[model samples]
Target: MTAQVQSAYAALRPADVVLSPDDLGGARATRHSFSRSLVRRAVAGGWDITLGRADLDEHGCGVVVFDVSAEGHRWSFVAFSQTIDESDREDRVVASSWDVTAALVDGAVDDDDVARLRPEVIRQEQGRADERTLIWTRANRSGRFFEYVVDRLADGAQPEPGVFGLSPYLLRSTAFYSNGKFGLADFERFEHGHPFAVPYRAHMLSAWLLRELGYELAERCAAARSETAVRLDGDWRRYFGLGNATGLGMVPYVVNHPEVLDAWIRLRELPLADVVARTVDRTGPDVPRVRTLLERAARYLAEQGDTEPTPYTSGAKLAAGLRPIQDLLTEYATYGTMGGAIEAQPWQHLHEAAAAAGSEVRGVVASVLTELADDLDDVVEASLTCQERRDIDPKMRCGELRGLIDADYDWLREFDFTDPTQTERFWYSSANNEEPRRAYAGVDPGERVQHAVDVARAVHALSLDLAGAEAATSVGEFLLGHPWHRGAVARVQSVRDLEYAELHANLLAGDFLPLHVQRLQLAVYGMDNYNPQSTDWLRVTLFSGAPRVADLVDGTADDDWSFTPQPSEADERTYA
Candidate 1:
């Protein structure tokens, strides 16, 4: 890391600000978000996506393909579409079928490839593919919005922007399988110099292509119905995104990938701190840009409407909280506009002011600050794509390991394992599909086979074992006598220096909220309009305000797509 980047790390917000579940859960998408970064890279690299073929019938059952070219490489998105009854459409992993199944394959797709992939892709989990396939995914049409848009367009009228009052997606992708799952290529196969070299970029790109396919399917269905059928307006087209329903499977992922989680948190927090420390020039674009972002965020929040009631924070409440922050920013902007000297570290002051409101508002402020730290993009990207490896230092003295735990794993001491509530939940894989599941310890079976997500308990146990060992004994020597501590010891030694590597909360605690962890992961993926459907699962939209295919092709893409305000009837005339 450069000296400038090191300074940013030094200024990172306190752990309470950066790692608390409440604050992390409230995170909004910033420019560094995976989806946003992918789009920016796509535009910068002059990536092109074009329709390859569409062979659908009136019922919308057929094959559709899109060819994506980036840099010197080519890939194809092969989609198999079929109409399914509403009852058959399920988001649970246990479901055996979906409305559409697709694969993002390496190189150009030919007739034989499509024919071969058709049956396999439809089989989903039971399917098999070659190493050429990068991503395997499936989606179901959004019952509430899909046909509504199709019918409206067939009737020669644009759907009202309010049609997106609940969601802007026509299809909800429930799963994206990659990284060598079910015969697909492992990440290492293409991680070096591919367009999707960054982890999960292929998945995000697949989701974006699916969004485009959804638009195409809707248009095709509409055109079949009437001669007057029209395509979606440009503004509405860009507004449409891909919906996703994530469940308990993601919770274990967050726990298992501590290094990745740490990298994401630090990348976001450090840039925010750097921006906050900068002297704000009221006469410059920074103040106005921040003000604009605040206004856009408030408008976006106000426009959000949940399909069902959720216990999590509602958009309306967030919007209400934002009013005060917006008012404060407006005052600051006005003071600068009136030739008054702006306060030093005005951005920091703004952040401090937002902190007083709550974590949600504080996160919003931090996201806006990150947006202004444009110079840190390369640093952020490098950190995200860097190889993350956790290796045990077997030669380290047991006394040193114990001290490391005491200093870095201090949060582990908060939990009392003697209490049943602290050890109530256990994570295990379901037999049906090996899907990750959480269940109560005594009431549920499979505790014996529980996954090792209880880091706090493991470290606590390791600390006790270390106390009994000789202080001068090396970790390898101690582990030989207590093999179970190897995992704990390695994790401790690996992440001791990574400040944000461990979540401070106990995953097995009775009061632990899995949705908070899920929210944090989704926020990093650049999802928006969080709607927690249950304690273990929630719905979110990707690329809601993202540029459409035409925008990218025409070089009209806008970087300022985050927190998109809802379009209105007036947009019809404005875009026209």
Candidate 2:
């Protein structure tokens, strides 16, 4: 379709660009402290699973199923679980009997269809590529939350949120799937009619569907206990969200899809920089907006369930700094004013004050402010296109070779490879090339046989060699003399900003650490950030609190792919 057709294809319209990091940081101050990063911040804070809303945990079953429709467009989740031996239910890709395995079908399965497919879906490999399928997935139960919810609900009671002592709302976080990974809809299905618009927010949508499907499975299994066990009430049905755990595998995707990632990161960065840069008073329109934002954020923080909440000292510092700012602004402010007076850039002032207080709340504050700026297709619409398709002009001058690398990136050489700690860590793919495995120094077979694709070090080393190369030669010609950097040279030339992409530390050195490399990639992908010094920590957030298939019918307006609050006829509360 033409660009015009695509723009107006379904229901594309202009809306706010999206929250920026500065605004996000300011918003964070309204509630918590810590050098809040736009791309990095605490969310979902816990593993609580409730349906529809955070409250009403008593009726939760940690499982939900989607009801299928006929147009070949509808989808459903079929989750399976049995009291399997924990040893048999490992989370590895090779495990045969996972605690949960699911598949999406072309059409709704009646009792007969469901019965037949149950065995087939359980046969994950057998159904791995059924064309009509959009997504297929599984998760080993928390072993704790799974059994706890079942026991309590089976006994006609809600699971107390204390068996594990996490926030009551965060009990059911585990695993989920999305897209047409196995037998679900092809990614194209989501593109059809922009059906996924608004209600479809990536893998989380599927997880939410799985949550409902999980509830159904639990209800069916529990029906043997009592027919009354089924929660048929509207309120009972409207509670529950799914929790997911992802890992290092997600890091690469952010690097790969720069546009989408950039949309999120750039919007965050640009906005926060904008808000924090301002240095004015609180007499303008933003004062009240910030006040309301403070109220909501505080409410959100209170409502927040901390399987792990932002640290208290951090939270206190943020709160301590922000209240005074808000108070001052409110005292000097008028209602409904737009920007603060010429000198009263209240929003910007908040950033400055926080900065003085050593508050790094700018990230979350950016998110809050992003919600305020009423225009942002540019921010949210940033597309992720790979720019690594350049053909290296291997003919540049030798002097030019060293010049570009140093100027573009202050490439410098300083590392001792003989140190075991530096080169201690190694990355190798599984025999299948799917999972990435890390090994300690001197232990892994692929240590000396490692991939020489370390862009930064390679570039720096190339720079040093180029400087020493016979002069009066072009970079392309220099490559003829020193072909070792062929790969590095091509890569450096293609990527717009190589410095932003590579880890500064030398992996070959005894002090080489992979945690920062992993963290940076994860942060870029919008994945939750953590210090995974062990490389074993890998969890991602998907389908946590989003809409399901039903919303596709009822939710007409479209902005982002999120849940729309059903509007009352009087108020016309649209989700978009």
Candidate 3:
């Protein structure tokens, strides 16, 4: 709202290109990512998270509780751990059992609360909870890594850091359910005047707790096996993160909540623009900081190597692309030192160079630039409570509606709805759990009950109808004559000012990759090491380099944990 903020918004990349699926898919986590911001807030608020209870046997089957106190507010994370057969450990929403189930409660958990939550948390969707519970979630142990860590610790040694080459997680969370799902507290209760008022703060915090719990479970199981077993090395402990497997369930959220999506993209883009603009005029402190961030990113990417090859670019390829950009930055630093005069926006030149390399490289550069913005926390926190309204202006003339579509929805023309492939897919909810699923239109029987995620098709249909209507006809009158176009009209009108609201691609298209949408949402949540298992679902790690429980309690947490590199061999020696 300030002049400076307005200038920053003005500098954002053109909406058409940034909002495209290709660009959004390449987005990486930055300091402003929800998970990173949540950790920063915890550190600033002097939050204390400590283990409250541990009642597990050598097999790590029992209940554990963690008490959390933040800014005089109390909460508890009650976890129920149980050993499960490998075949029973599934990440799908339809899965019946898991290695661990937990809930984040609104108040301090007591004996009665744990006893009451135990049965419900384990039962997942089949169970129920009261309004006091904020989140209900479950995780499965990361098969080989979990066992390797426990075995190494039990032998009074440390697992080699190379063991985490594939993933730096001990457990993979299947889902985190909240917002009145199965009777948990609705978002309205804590959306305001609560410590976790920021949209996904509670969810991210729960994920952090899950990561901590994974470490505890590993240590407990190891200690039970040997008298010499010791706690995991501090660095290794922080290196571990909570894993997550997300599928089609998130695609609809991306489609249905354009306002929320726009806010997230705008917040990230605006800060990046501001950083570039401010730094273009000078080689200030941020110049070196940007270089340092780039170095970290390159190293992290190199360490991660190539993930399972899918349609997306691999980390190794991204690392190779970054090499030239790194050299270019070093050259820029030399020019600044040699007292070179202003040419044509050196920062813009650098960005252009990155773009030429690849879309993923461009995103990496943009994410790094965001780290240099002064208003990151301010912008992110202010945008936390979305004020977007999808209400239609029924009084507006049909001509105006058509004009808005012509200007903003021009991208809709790119798709040919007549082509069977463009309309091949339809999204629907599963009857068993109401989980979102996409199916081939004719091949799948759910087309009759399909969800309305076909924004492109809707806009095309609406435009065709508008062509025949009188120019001065009001949208209300137009909708009254053709009620089928109501949702499309409202959607087109509501996003008139929200440039990044709608994805430019047709979700129903046969070649449309849902993983791109998933990656975008996960990047916003600060997830790392995106390993695509298939086109529709993927595995990601959250809070991988974030502070451990000890750091939060000791007030040593910082926000420089993004783009975490792999731990070196020397790090493992500390435990030995």
TM-score of each: 0.95, 0.65, 0.96
Q: Cα miss at 27, model 2 (Å)?
A: 14
What lDDT tens digits, residue by residue, belong to model 1 across residues 286-324?
Answer: 888888888888788777643333656566777788887
Candidate 2: Cα lDDT at 76 = 57
Clashes of 3: 0
Please give, for residues 462-510, the per-residue lDDT of candidate 3 as tens digits. Answer: 9999999999999999999999998998899888988788888999998
lDDT of each: 0.83, 0.43, 0.84
Best TM-score goes to which candidate?
A: 3
Any idea what lDDT model 2 has?
0.43
lDDT of 3: 0.84
Full candidate order by TM-score, most accurate first: 3, 1, 2
Error of 2 at 255 (Å): 5.4
| Cα lDDT over the full model 1 | 0.83
What TM-score should be assigned to candidate 1? 0.95
| Clash number by candidate, in order | 0, 86, 0
Give a tens-digit lDDT track for model 2, residues 439-491. Answer: 56577686665545345457766777877876677767777777888877775
lDDT of 3 at 82: 95
